[model samples]
Each structure stands twice: as C-alpha cells, then as structure tokens.
Target: MTILIPAMTQAENHPVSLTDDRGKTIELAQPATRPAAISTFGADVSVALGRQPVAITTFGLQGVPAYLGPEMEKIPSLGPRHQPNLEQLSRIAPDLVFAIRRYTEKDGPQIEAIAPMVAMDLITLQDSLDAVALAGDALGRPQQAREINQRFKARLDSLAARSPGNRTVAILTSGGETPFVYYDHFLTASLLERLHFDNVGGSPPNPESGIPLGYRISLEALLALNPDVILLLPSNRQRGFTVNPVWPYLQAVKNDQVFEVGQHWKESAGPIARSLVLDDIERLLLPDDTPLKTSSR
Candidate 1:
C-alpha cells in the first residue's frame, strides 16, 4: 500500500537483478530457497514472511533475539553480523545472504565466495517495507508480503488518526556516565513519532555511524524538554534508575512514566521489528476508556 515496493521490480525471474540501498546491484542466478540473514533484521523479516532462515547472524557475546519465540530454539547461529564466520557459513551453504548495506560494502567480495549477498538499508519505514517485499520475492511469498504491508499501513494510519495531542515523550539510552537522549534514526523514537507522540528531543544529528546511542545532554537540557513520558533503553525496572535521588522534580520520574523495554525498540531495524514496536507502544499509551480501534497483529 505504501508503494515502496516498485511494481516493475520482480526478483523471482532468473538472474534477478535488484539494487540495494548502497546502489550495489545484486544478481542472483536463481531465487534463494535456503537463505541466510547477516543480521537479526533479515532473520525477523524472513520469519514474518513465513520462511525461516537456515542460519542467522549472531552478535558474539550479545547473541541474537528471540523474535520467533519457541521457533527461535531451532535456528542456528552464524556468528557476528558485520564480521561473520565465513567458514561456518560455507558449511551452511545457503543460496543467498541478506546484509545491512553499509556494513557489507567492504566485505562484498569475500561474502560472495560463501554465498551471493543482497544488501539493504533499513533507514526508514519505507526502506524496511521495500526489503520485506524483496524478501517475499526471494522466498516465493510475494502475496504474504503484500498482505503484511497493507495490514501494517492500515494499522499505522489508524494510530495516526487516533493519536492524542500534547503527549510528549523522551527516550534515554542506557550506557555512559549520562544516558543519551535518542530522537531520530532509532526505531522507538521514530515509530512513536509516527503514532503521533511528540518527541521533544528530536532525532540525532547523524544516524549512519550507529556507534553512539544518541546525543548526550545535561540534565538541565532534558528537564527543559519537560517530556511527559520517559522511555529508557537497555533498562530494567529492578535497576530503579528512575526512582533514584537524581531528580525528584522531573515530571516523568515523579509520575512513574519512565519505562524500560527490550533492545528491539532501540535496534534491529526491520519491518517485523517496527510492527513489534507499535505493539509495545499501543500497550503503554492506550487507555481502557480510549475509544481507538485495536491495531494488534
């Protein structure tokens, strides 16, 4: 429904030629049946389209996410996303591997030795949808992908129409002496904005590096934002950072609106991940009396 998926683009044909976000043309001898994803994003999209990856890119000590629940236990790990284990991947012998465009640029030549790779950029919602549609073609599930896309667009439209005004939110990234305030280039803040939540912090200055969680700001600047809701990343309720003696006057801390969520909201840029993020927000923002249509998938 978003039209991000070009009507003329068809990957099912032999010698499929598709250009990734980096403008690299991915030429496939045939559509990949047994595929592999170089990151959690690719793996999640695969599962959403009703096909599981033979292997998923791992994150060293961090490991991959359990997006598929019980099905997660069945999938094998393929090492780190950026610097994958080519030896292990060769054994898996996948027909193709999906990768983040930026990370795979330098390693393209080497990765192709293991299996042809298709790189994608997950910068915005449309980008994620495009990647999903591409995956649908590769997995021979184009109809399923279109249905999911239509469903997602409807859900998003519903939220935009129903989102309340003046409910400002601020996101704090965990790590460093002072946790960073995330505005843009991250799923949580961006998606919340789409749902009509006013993000007081705004998006980060630069989004490509993916190193810094967000721009670190003094407590005074954060207080100036006066956000009604505060979301903390990589946080736990037991840590009790919100209840600390730091700021008794902060509205969010005083009102107990500070919440901690799993890493999916902060990282893992993909279509399925966005859907999961919307689910999380609807749970938190919607009220029992709020007369909005439920958009849960």
Candidate 2:
C-alpha cells in the first residue's frame, strides 16, 4: 500500500509550473511521460509515483541502482551524475530533465535546449521533502506526493520518539589513508541527529558556500573527536586507515563500533532511499531485542 497510483489531480487542468532549487521556474504543458533523471532523486521519485525514467545517470559508476530492481538496468545511462553525456541525453530526447543543482548549473543552458530541466538542491532533509513534492507536481501526482511526504514525516517522528540517547557518532567514507567525515547538515547525519545521535563533525565553520557534504579528516583529528560509533561507507572492502598505527587507539575501534554501510548512504535524498537509511540505522544502532516499527520500503 506504500506505493499507489492515484488519479491525476489539479496538474491536468492547468499547466504545471514550479521553481526548482536553482530558483529557475519551469513550466510544462502536460505531465511528463518521458523524464530523464540526472540525479537518483528524480528516478526514485518517478518510481514512487508509478513511472520510470526514460534515461538516468549511473550511481557512481556502478551503473543504475540494482536496489531499484532489474527494470532500472534497462534504462539508458546518461553517464555519471556529475557530468552526464549531453549527446546521449539529446539522443534519448526526454521530455523533461531532473538534475542536481551543483552538478548541472554550469551546463544548464545546454540541457534546457534539449528539454525542460529542473535543477534540484538535494542536500538537507527539507530539500528532499520539497524535491519530492516538486517532482510530484511535474509528474502529475501531487496528491500521491503529498501523501508520501506526510507518511515520511510521520515515520520520522515515530523513530525520533524511540531514540535511545545522544550517542556521539561520525559517518566516514574512503578506502584510502584519510577518511572523509560528514558535516551534520548532510542528509544522513541529519537523520542520525533526529534519532538523537550527536554528530562529532558538527556544523561547518562558515556558511559561505552553503551546505557542504563533508571534508577529509586526518587520523589525529579523528582521534581527538573520538565518536562513540563510526559508520564506514567504504568504496571497497580495503580500508587503508584500519592498518594505520593510530587506528587501535580510537574509542569506536577499541569497542568494535565501526560498521560498514551500503552505497545507499551516499545518495539518500529520495523517498525510497530515505526509508532504507532509516532501516539501516535501526538495524545497526538498535539492540536486537529492541521493539520498533520497521521502516523498510
């Protein structure tokens, strides 16, 4: 029942118009039937709205997301999420394009020439929620979009109410010598914070460049923070930092609190991705005996 195909709402009667995160207003004559997803958020939202994208960018060179099922593999790849092949996009001839604001801003004009483009700023939790609603409007599923948003908010509140305590944590990635620590405002960290986990990375020193994902942290700096739990989002199984001389001294390491998470943690702005993230948090952080409602989609 989580995924339903409701009847078309107000979008059918009038031209669909909404401003994207880049502050650019895009108007569609009718609901888009052949949208291209430059970011996974668009694809995720599309599927939730009972539709599939005509084309999509790869999930960090892994190709289309297998978690989205076998159907996703058949979609034409526009290449990497950052800089998709414009030629391929042009060939696909998508009616609309959903792009990540930071990645597509420089090439917005080129994309617009091919089709209407909506550049989304999918950084924070609010950004994700708003993006879903905006995408719903474009896809002509506004009512379903509102229902999804409401369900997500209600689920988030339920999880927060069951938070154990304020345990200090850090979300790290990289298979190399230094691991990148995420900022608190990063979507994953933001979710953990809502679950009452204190992010050791905290907010950035300056807000000049808007919200940053994370920064590389040295072993010495990481040791100083000494978070209670360390979530490792490695590119591969080979974690070079674990072999370092200073690795054993960290509190999380000493207590065996370091956990390796999946790729979903990297791009978790969509409805399905967010739900899976909550599932991971509950499975990894909560005790086996802990009784809580599952958030899996």
Candidate 3:
C-alpha cells in the first residue's frame, strides 16, 4: 500500500468501510461521489452499475468497445496502468479510486497519493461479478448490483436448464494472428461451464501467477480435440480460418459451427457484456431441437 493512502476507520474517522478482493480494507469518509476507475473494465462496470466514474485508464480507452457505448469516450483518461499522472488525476477531485490487483500490486502506493483505493480480483469470471458488487457498494447502490447479478445468474440458469447437455466447444480469439484457446476459468469459459457446455480448454487458472492461462493449440492439437463448436472472438467472420493448413479438416470448421463474437466474450464480467455472451450461447451453441430460452430471466 502507498504511504499516501489515508488512515481509514469508521465512526470518528472515515464513515464507510470497504474490503477489496485482496482482503485489504479501506475506510472512506463516505461513499465515493466522484470515483476514478483504473481500467476500461472498471469503467464499464461503473456505467453498468449506474455510477459512471469521471476518469478511466489511458491504455485501451479508445478500445473500450462498442458495448460500453458513447459514454466511454466522454470520460478523461489517466496515464498507463503502471504510471498515472498524479497532478492531472488530482485535478479531477476524485473521492475514490478503483483498480484490480494486477495494477494495485505494482502501483498501489503511487495511486494512493491521489485517493484511497479499492483493488480487487477482476481477471476471471467470478472476480468480474464480485467487481459489480464492489462498485455498487462504493457507489451506495448495493441493491442494484444484487439485482444485476441475480438477473445475470437467472439467465444462466435458464440456459443451463435448456442446454443440450453433451456438447464440447472451444473458444478462439483474434487478438493474435492465430486464435488461442482460452482456459476453463476465463470469463467466457466460465459462462460456458454454467450453461453446461463441455469445454475443451485444456488449461486452467494458474495459482502462482494469479492469471488464467491460454494456449495457442497447434493444428495437430486442435485436430485431436475436434470440438463441436469454435467461438471466434474479436472477429465473427470465419473465412480467415482457411489460413491454417488443416483448418478445412476440423469438424467445427467443416460444419459451419464457427461463431463470431464481440467484446463481451473478452469482458466476461461486465453486466451488459455477460448478458450478450449468454445471448450468443443460446443463439449459436444450443441444439436446433432444443427450445430457445428467453434472454430475460
């Protein structure tokens, strides 16, 4: 923690007590009225929870994706995650700062100089939902967060109830030249697990690194698994699959089962993003014989 962080407490001191994913507790004079999120993910959550922080991180601010809508572009941005402009940040007069452990671990002390911080585990599926709750608490809107989470879970429950039950799928991302299969604990994969879709992600979350791992499976490895469906993120078009030498022979490739997705898959935790993910799962992965479930719970 940074030396700049204010000494926090309740009663005679800061009025509200909040605990982050790292188990670090912070006491706020009151619920934050003007917060600054440290990343695009945090910014999206703020809007989803109806708070819409005044400041967001610099990197990827433009790439916040269409799902976040126009408000994303309206907010001012801090410097990169590792180093933000403290003088500029102070000018914003933010009451609170929200960040993930990835950023907090490296820059917590420096960021603390601007405002007290709430750093949480937001890299995976479970963390994302937790982040929504934290944002709600920070903004004094816990009920809204609860309602949103319940709705998200209910939608998943509906999907699970109507799932085909015995199908395998693989997620591929266009963030790189060759699509890499995401690990089981990644946001989208976790949603797939909830929907009862058999996942082919051979990797899992790495405990030491505190990061969910992804592997760019070779053509031979992909051929061996031959998952029933291949979800393509960042790009929905599947014609690019032809670049791989054995792409034409893959089952998902041949059967027209390759589905394209948007930023929601990448941002599995955002309220709106997760909702879209469920929508896509129902539209693309479910069996034609299965009755479609309404997106609304």
Candidate 4:
C-alpha cells in the first residue's frame, strides 16, 4: 500500500486541527467532548474511544447498535443517518459533529451553523481507517484510534493468510426477486476480496459516487454470474428470490453456501462493526478453526 500512517500515541494540548474527507480544515480550541454523530461511523468510533456521543443517527431499524450495548439507546437519536433531524440536533447543542460526506454535503453549511462538522468518506477500507484516525484526533484519543487501525490491519492479514483458495463470491442484498449485487469496492466486499475471494461484481463503471453500490440483478443475470458463494445481506427477512425456479440451480444455493449475514455486514466501516464482521466471516467460512479473540471486540 501507501506510507503507513504514523501513530498519534499521545494526546496533545495543541488545538485539534485536521482536514476532513470534505477537504475542509476543522479546527477546535481543545478537543470535542460533546459531539453529535450524524453518521454511524462517528458514533461507532466515539464509543470505541471510550466516549459516548451526546446524540447519534439511527443504525437502520435496530436504532443504536446493540453491539455498542443498551446504553446507546438512551442517547438521543437524530432520526435517520441520511436525513438527520437538524432541529433536534441544534437543540442538543453539541460542540462538534461527525458526518458522512455524501449524505451531509448538502447540509454542510446548516450543520456547521450549529457545530463544526467533520464529514467522513466511509466507503472503502482505507476510508474507514482514515476516519478512525481523524475521529481519534478530533476526540483527543488519537493513540486509541491508531491502535484500533493497527489491530484491524493485523486481523485482515491473518484472515487473508487463512482464506480458502480463490473462490468466486458475491455479496447480495434485497429479499425481492431482483437482488442488488455489491461491487468489490464496498467495505464488506473489499474485506472478502482481501481474503482472496474473487468478487463477481468487480468494480463499478462510475467511480465517483459508487452511488448505487450494488446493481439490481435479474435471476437470469445472476445465473450468468453463478458465484461459488453468496453472502446475503438482506434489507429484511422476507426473501422472495428463494422461491424462484432459478434459485435452487445456482451453485451457492445448491451447495448450501447462501449465508444470511447481519446488518454489520452492510454498515461495516467502524472499528466495532468491522471487527464483528471478521468474526462472522471466520465463523461462517472457517468454522473448524478456533475463533481467535482480539482487543478490538
């Protein structure tokens, strides 16, 4: 890869100043104590750093992450991550705000009016690592963030070393007749690819947004791909595709390789979520081996 990011092993008294994913310099007099998380990554990183956000965006239908424990539920919710309740957020009066670039870009000025928003690009594996570092610095826990990243990298290397031979795989979502197949650049897909799983969706044609991270596929199209394994990240439990005549004929379905994974597989940019993802992969794919525990969990 590129140059290894130097560890910020100690907290600094100097003003916390860093460029965000939006390429804007966010400077704080000290460090943020009461931060509002408009993105789940923000909430995820904050909790991992031993600090709870004053308020946080919802984590799908599950509300605050259950993995983060029940205490998170007590924290005020800003509704949905994409369109958080700005009025509610302003009332909380947080000192800083962590947000997703794509989701909050339009509301950047509005968010900044209340508190300085550090918009993060939480798409790829590298983005996740960078966001953790940025959040660590912002929250005055740079060292913890650095350690988290190091542990994550180590885990990836370990998983890659143990991954089975280049088996073609696909991360599919939606329970409907037409499933949305993830491109390799998506966080979970990237993790799988790192473990030597060849992603059938490869990369998207339009690189800028990766907007439609997954392309909706017909049963005919899925059959043409016929991946060896299918990791089903359903939006809900109702799987309409299972009843189709073509479903049973697929290689993964016939061989009993169609595994239904949790929401962590979808929103997997944060340290805790990603670590849990590694656990799931190990449990699902490397079942015979004993699960190795790590500080990340």
Candidate 5:
C-alpha cells in the first residue's frame, strides 16, 4: 500500500528545503501554493504540476490556447510577464510567485510584501525540464510532472530521428511594415535548433524599441540569408488578419516554402504548444511527395 503525505514547507528562517539541478539543498520561505506565474514558461510549469494559478501573465490578443485543459481561461489576467499589474496581483494574494529572476529582482520588495516570491532560472531545454520537475515537487505532483517531461523528451527524440540534415531555416515576425529576424536564444529559435535546422546568422543589431522582444531585419537582409524554409509569426493587428504583402517577393515565399505558425505554438511553453510546434516543424523538414498549401495565413 502507498501512503501520501502533505508537502513540506520551510520553517521561518530555517531555509525552505528544495533540491537544485546539482542536488544541492535550496532554501526558501515556504512551499508554493496559489502561485502566480509571472512568465509563460513559469505558467507552463504550474499547469503541469496540477495547480491552477489564481492569476497569470498575458501573452497577446489571441490569449491562452484552448487546449490547456480549459481551466486556463478561468485564471485572472495579470497582464504581461515583463510588465505585471501590481493592482491585480495584490488582489489575488498569491502565496508564492514564480518568475524569471532578471525581471522579478527589481520588484522583489514590492512582490515579497504581498507574498514570498521565488525566481526561477529557465535558460536551456535542460533548465526548463528541471524547472518543471521542481515545480511539480513544490506543488506535490512530482509523478505527473515527470511523466510530462518524459513524453516531451521522447517526442524530441522522435523529431530528431525524422529530421533531414543541412536545412537552413529562419524565423521571422511578420504583419508590420518591416519583418524581423529572431535571435538564436529566443524560444522560436530554440524550437528550430531541436529539429537540427541551422539559423542563418547571429542576432540582429539593436532591434527597434518596443517592437516586442526580437531582432528586426529588412527584406534585403532576409533575401541575403537565402534560407530554404521560412516560419512566420503573425501579429495581433488588422494587417495580420489579412494577407501578407511581402510574401510574394522572398525566395522561400516564391518557392512556396513559407509556413504560418500559430500564436499558441510560437508563444507558449506548455506541453501541448510544444508538441504542436514539433509537429509543424516535422511537416516542413520531412520530404513529402504531396504538395501542400504553402501559407496558413
């Protein structure tokens, strides 16, 4: 017979006990409950752990994906991860808040006053997997979290096996006057890297201010790259709802190699979204004799 015990919490000034990546003891004020995920990645972790957050940071106009098991829509919107709404957050009265350390550090005192806040470090794929596990443990749902991690790894392996080598790919943000090129470290670039595609160049120099969080490139720069495949992320604007003006000119566009990525797949970090991203990339990278529609726009 198996026995279940309540999750552990750290005593006052006694160091909240948790294990790090290296299996070192990590101390915090208490176990996480009623968590407010300050980033999409953190929200993914919370959802995987079976604890529905009271509030979550928003992504864009499309909002959270419908397939996040339907409980997502009920959570109160706390605005963007980069810029959280303190007023809404205060009303939620979260017991713990999980966010990227870089973004949360500045508002530490303010957030801590409402509740104990912990900064999660999720840089690489490994880091993300570990963070998920940690979140599961904190939320008393370790088994479910491990299963999700295992499934994701298995899917990644399958994608790697089916992928063709030496395909040059580029990720672009569209719907504006000028399309933008994404850097290697961005989430979309990370997804492409998993499928063994090569990003054409390094990050763009000094992307425009307040143009989302990516590097911008001119049409001339995109043509210079000469990629075999192009993945376009649409904006939440009127122009995005209609046709793409620059689609007819590019090499990939001319060759019918352009593919449209949905907002949920490109933006969210949860299991379902990641799986969709993997499937989309597989369809593009694998050689199928059937000629399908080029643009989903």
Candidate 6:
C-alpha cells in the first residue's frame, strides 16, 4: 500500500513554501520521499531525518574517530563536496533538492527545472543544528532530531565542564601563500565555540579576504596566527605525505598539536555530522581519563 503524506508548514505561520537560491518560490506538495542533497552537510541532514537521499556529495573522513561509524562511506557519491554532477542529479528525479545557499543562488534555476530546490543557509554550527530540526520537522522526525540535538549539547557541555580554561584556536583553510581564517558565522568557528574554545582575531582583515563557503587557504597567514591547535584539510592534488612544510616550524606545529580532521566535519554542518564533529572535539579537548557523563538523551 502506498502512503501519502501532506506537505507540512515550517512553523504555524511560516507556510510550506520556500525560496530557492535564485529567489524562486517553490512549494512542497507533500513531505519529500526521494530527496537529493547537494552538500555533504545536507546529505547528513537527509540521513538524520531517516531519508537516505538518492544522490549526495562526497565526504572526507581520514582522521575521524571510530564511534562516528562508517555511514558516509555507504552513500552513493555524486561528485566532489562542492561541485556536484548536475546531469547525475537530474537523472535522480528527486522529489526535493536541498542545496547550500551559494550553490542554489548560482545554480538554483537549473536545478529547479529538475526538482523543487530549496537553498539552505547553513554557515554556522547553530544554523546547522536548526537546519536538522527544520528538516526533521518537515520529514516528521521531530523526536529523532531533538535527540540528536540533545546528544550534541550534552557532549559539548561535558567538554566545557572538564576544561574551564579557554584555549585560543585559529581554524584555517590551508593552501596558497595566505591561508584564510573562518569567522563568526562560519562552520568551523561555530563548532569551536560550541566546545567552549575561543577563536583568535575577529573577522577577515578585508571583505575580499573571506574565502567562499568551500574554498582552501595558504600557509603564510596560518604561521602568523600561531594557533594553539591546528586542523588540516586533506589535499586532493597532493598524492604523498604533503606536510604543512613551513608551518611545522611554528609553535603549534612543533608541539604536535596539529590534527587532521575530515573536510566534511569542517565544511558541513548537520545534526548527525555535527554530532560526530562534537565527539571528535571532545576527544581533542578532554583527556581520556575524563569520564563520559550519562547522556541526557
């Protein structure tokens, strides 16, 4: 028997319609059954809401811990995290297509022709959490979404309780000559703040200095910050052991405080993925001797 569900409004007054990245109003006839997510974070939200999207961008998981599990590896790869295969996406004929703001703004009209597209604004960690909850509400999984949120908050609180002292960190997208640092609304900064860590410096020096949502950075500026801990994004162009090269001589690098985290965690913000990120952050901030508090979930 086929089950039919009606389209649910975002909030009591918000309604069931949303603007695509290109500013087109797309109305949902019903909750999406076959969803297509353009970003890795969007894919995580789809999975968290109990709908495995037919297509999804790829994820990087080189150094993630074991508890996060192997969920990402199981999904069908559409293409690189930021650059998705439009032709492949079109073939899927998804009921709903969720994409990042930039992706939708640039390609929404093209994607909308294939399916109803909704551009999600998920620049910050809080935004990511809210997106998950919103997706869950839309998909009728409010309880599951709430549980995920609680789990993340509990882990973050535990980490904060352990380290009352704040450590100043600088998150950079390492590449080129001048690495770009993420600011307040960026995903990495939001994640670090949730863990009770302070990000050094405020905003980019210039408006043009800000890297687009999913771009890489250089090493020269990274050395200048001399952050307490360094998170490295894996290099697709480099085949072998490509170290930070110059930055390794810096204080943070010399102390072996540099960690290689997955691009997905740093780049994407979703309930399940963010939960995994919070877990990794907990491992990074707290000692192994620190016991896990019983989760409120």
What would the per-residue lDDT of candidate 6 be over residues 51-164, giving only the tens digit for each residue? 878777654433222223466556556675456778988787887777777655667678789987767667766666666765665455656877888887776676755653
Q: Which residue pairs in model 5 clash with each other?
A: 16-28
Model 4: per-residue Cα lDDT over 1-297, one tens digit each: 121223553345547777887678877876788989997788888899987899999967767768777888899999998889999999999989999889997888999999998888788898899888888888888788999999999989887766764588988888687888899889999898887789998797776765668788888788898999999884755777778899989999999998988777888888999999999988887646534434332
For each candidate in the order shown, give its overall lDDT on alpha carbons.
0.71, 0.83, 0.73, 0.83, 0.65, 0.62
Instruction: Write down the TM-score of every candidate.
Output: 0.84, 0.91, 0.84, 0.91, 0.76, 0.75
Model 3 residue 14 CA deviation in Å: 9.0
How well does candidate 2 match the true structure in TM-score terms? 0.91
Superposed on all Cα atoms, the candidates' RMSDs to the truth, in angstroms, are 4.3, 4.7, 5.1, 4.3, 7.4, 6.3
Off by over 4 Å in 3: 1-14, 58-62, 79-87, 174-178, 203-210, 235-242, 287-297
**Per-residue accuracy of model 1 over 33-66 as CA lDDT, tens digit each:** 7888887777887888777788888654547776
Worst-scoring 10-residue span by lDDT in model 1: 1-10
lDDT, candidate 5, residue 72?
84
Backbone collisions counted per model: 2, 0, 2, 0, 1, 4
| Candidate 1 ranges with C-alpha deviation above 4 Å | 1-15, 59-62, 204-213, 235-245, 291-297
- Model 2 weakest 10-residue run by lDDT: 1-10
Candidate with better lDDT, 4 vs 5: 4
User: In terms of TM-score, how similar is model 3 to the real structure?
Assistant: 0.84
CA shift of 162, model 3, Å? 1.1
Model 4 residue 110 lDDT score: 92
Candidate 5, residues 1-297: lDDT per residue as tens digits?
Answer: 011223453232333445543333444554566888787766777776667888888777666656565788888988877778888999999877777655676776787788666565454455566677666656656678789989988877666665664777787775766666766555557667766778764543443221234566766676778788887776775433124555466677778887877765454455556666777777766765423423321
- lDDT by residue (29-137, candidate 2, tens digit) is 8778899999998888898888799999987646776667789988998889888899999999998998889999788999999999988878888788888888887
Worst 10 residues of 6 by lDDT: 1-10
Candidate 6 has a TM-score of 0.75
Clashing pairs in 4: none
